[model samples]
Target: MENEQIKTIFEKEGITSEIQCPKAFEISEKYGVSKMEIARYCNKNNIKIRACQLGCFK
Candidate 1:
């Protein structure tokens, strides 16, 4: 998915700076995108994903 699309989803879902475990899984399932991909995107864009198993951005 495009970065703008991803950002839109995050914004629509109220996932601003941080995404918790449940929200992460929810977005993964809801958007048909993997948790790793979301985590990676957030990490690359300087957003924080709390308590993710993939260890987002330190």
Candidate 2:
């Protein structure tokens, strides 16, 4: 992940700070949504960081 791109993802998501072990599933699961939904969201937003990208779909 490029430095600027990482910054952009956080700022775009209104999460402008450091977070820890922050898996997308944590947010989606609480909404009764599929983890894959988060993956798609990231893709749509152009946040291509591999750690955030996932293979959670069946």
Candidate 3:
């Protein structure tokens, strides 16, 4: 989803009220994996990820 568009949806759900989801890092940690592992896996899978750089979830 477009970042801004996602933010609005999150706000309605009382998540950020300004931004979408706290951040990717926070999400990854919950999955029991380092952020680096996530990046590497994404690359290996040919997902074309260019570093999460979100620094929001982890």
Global lDDT of each candidate: 0.78, 0.45, 0.40
lDDT of each residue in 1-58, candidate 3, tens digit only: 3334433433444443222233335534554445555444434434343233555223
Top-down lDDT ranking: 1, 2, 3
lDDT tens per residue, model 1, 17-55? 888877888888899877767867787788877775655
Stretches off by above 4 angstroms in model 1 are 53-58
List where candidate 2 sits over 4 angstroms from the true fold: 1-22, 48-58
Model with the higher TM-score, candidate 1 or 3: 1
* Candidate 2 structure quality by residue, lDDT tens digits, 1-58: 4434544555564643322225445544444445555445455556443343344522
Worst 10 residues of 1 by lDDT: 49-58
Pairs of residues clashing in candidate 3:
23-56, 23-57, 24-57, 25-57, 25-58, 26-57, 26-58
Worst 10 residues of 3 by lDDT: 15-24
Task: Evaluate model 1: give its lDDT.
Answer: 0.78
Query: Model 1 compared with the native: what TM-score?
Result: 0.77
Q: Count clashing residue pairs in model 1.
A: 0
Tally clashes: model 2: 0
